[model samples]
Target: MKTYFPYQLKYVGVLFVFIAIVLSCIGNVDEFMRGLLAGRNDFETSILNEEATKVDQTLAYQPYFSEKEKDNYLKISLILSLSGFILYLFSKEKSEDEFYQQLRAKCLTQALLVTWLFTGLIYWIRPTYQLNGFYILQLHLIFFTIIYVYNKKWKFGTE
Candidate 1:
């Protein structure tokens, strides 16, 4: 019988948008990673004078990222996807509690950290096309900061 605050809905809406944006960027990164694998093969085959498979040049390969780096990229993807889903399910007015607040903070922190790592990796790799897209990083930072500030006075502060 408890009614939820209107601001609660807004908070949920903002979180959902943040989650959606992060998810979309992660999906694009995954596609790019696949292209990188294909491009590496193509580069090797071309060097050997073998036929190279058609590679989408638009999908560029990140130079200097070894297998470990590639696996790290995938790890973030899985973490973000799973955490985002869990947050969405628990982000409700009636369900709002310390648990939910802590969950949101944790999810945002993970997303921001992953964003920073990914951007740093791309910068370190120095791709051929100078793929310096930091939009996703900025978005995550803004969202994380906003949410952290909002939850600071709440029971779950940076949990």
Candidate 2:
């Protein structure tokens, strides 16, 4: 069995996550720059001061890849975060042994089962609420980490 992510990519994954975090916090790139120059949050100030016009308010409703691209940034950040997380999770460990591979497979299977169950329960409880790709990915990552930690700590701790 081969590892899809090289051990060195662990550092890259961390960098990607950091970048994603920064991206997620950023509201509008143009506005952030303006805020930096003005030494304040330009968007909020504009709206609060009644300086934001109808056109400025309509910026968020623009096309995804349009000039502003407010929501696009958030979507990109989410995708980068998920990709980085998976890369980090599956990256080769120091040992890279058969036991580790088997454990990874087992943990992933258990994670998938648990994520599906959780998703079903959430929908059963709230039928009108919709789950997005990022939400599902987060659940998958959460369950995978939990299962992986449990297996490593309890099932094979003595080994």
Highest TM-score scorer: 2
How far residue 11's Cα lies from its native spot in candidate 1, in Å, is: 12
Candidate lDDT values, in order: 0.54, 0.75
lDDT of 2 by residue, 1-40 (tens): 4578888887887787788889876745665655454544
Worst 10 residues of 2 by lDDT: 55-64
Model 2 TM-score relative to the real fold? 0.64
The estimated TM-scores of all candidates read 0.31, 0.64
lDDT of 1: 0.54
Per-structure clash totals for the candidates: 0, 0
Candidate 2 stretches with Cα past 4 Å from truth are: 27-68, 153-155
lDDT of 1 by residue, 46-69 (tens): 775433443334435655455566
lDDT of 2 at 77: 86
